[model samples]
Target: MEIVVSISDMKVTSRAKDVIVTHALGSCLGLAAYDPVAGVAGLIHCLLPLARDSKAPQKNPAMYVNTGVPQMMRAMFGRGATRENLILKAAGCGRMMHISNQFDTGANNFAALQKLLQVNEMHLSAEDVGGTIPRTMRLFADTGRLVISSCGRSWEL
Candidate 1:
């Protein structure tokens, strides 16, 4: 089974048959956390860096990196996954616009997610981020295989 995580959404599962996936990651971030021992996995598709401007966080915490990352982690932890055992990985955060002086949401999104992981005492093992191309991310629950795809190629993060 393939579970799609839309923008500002998240999902966690321990079923080996489920594969969590998220797409259209331009100027957005995809976060994946998995516990190999417990066979639990989660994925978050965050659209922004912060949630201070609106009530989106209160309603859908997965809309911002600040809240989404930790929220996704907790969902995984609830499925017999330990905080320390969680393997964190991220993708996307692409530079979609050519203007250098722009706000650069992708960079901000990456930085915010990094801070969140650091604050949670989580170690990010790998990532494929920061480019001028959009990408799709996936998490295989059975094997905890995280992959990022772009430009007609794909690699494990």
Candidate 2:
């Protein structure tokens, strides 16, 4: 089964037949985590760097990197994924828009994610980020395989 994780959304599954995916990652981010021993996988797509920076009321925690990444980690652990066994990978964070350097949402998003992971003593095993192109990320629940696709090219992360 293929589970699509939309913008500002997340999905976690332990089913071996499940494949979690997120698409069209421009300034947004696609984060994937898997625990091989537990056969668990998770994916999150975040639109902004932090929830506190948003002017509107925060409805979904998955809308920001600060909240979304931790939420996904907790969800994965709840599904039998352990900290030491978890493998993290990320994609997206591209400079897709013609915005000023100060308003570089993609760079800010990636920085926020890195800080969050560092604070939690976690690190990304692989990442394909920081380009002017969009990307699609996928996580195979059965084998903990993470793949990133961009510009008609796909490769394991």
lDDT of 1 by residue, 1-157 (tens): 9999999999999999999999989889998988999999999999999999667789989999988887877777778999878888888888886545568999999999888777877768998888888888889999889888888999888
**Model 2 / residue 139 / CA error / Å:** 0.9
All models, RMSD in angstroms: 1.2, 1.7
* Model 2: number of backbone collisions: 0
lDDT of 2 by residue, 17-99 (tens): 99999999999989988899888899999999988856532578899999888888889888888999989888899899656
Against the true structure, whose TM-score is highest?
Answer: 1
Whole-model lDDT, model 1: 0.88
In candidate 1, what residue range of length 10 has the lowest lDDT sum? 93-102
Candidate 1 colliding pairs, count: 0
Off by over 4 Å in 2: 53-58
Give the lDDT of residue 97 in candidate 1: 63
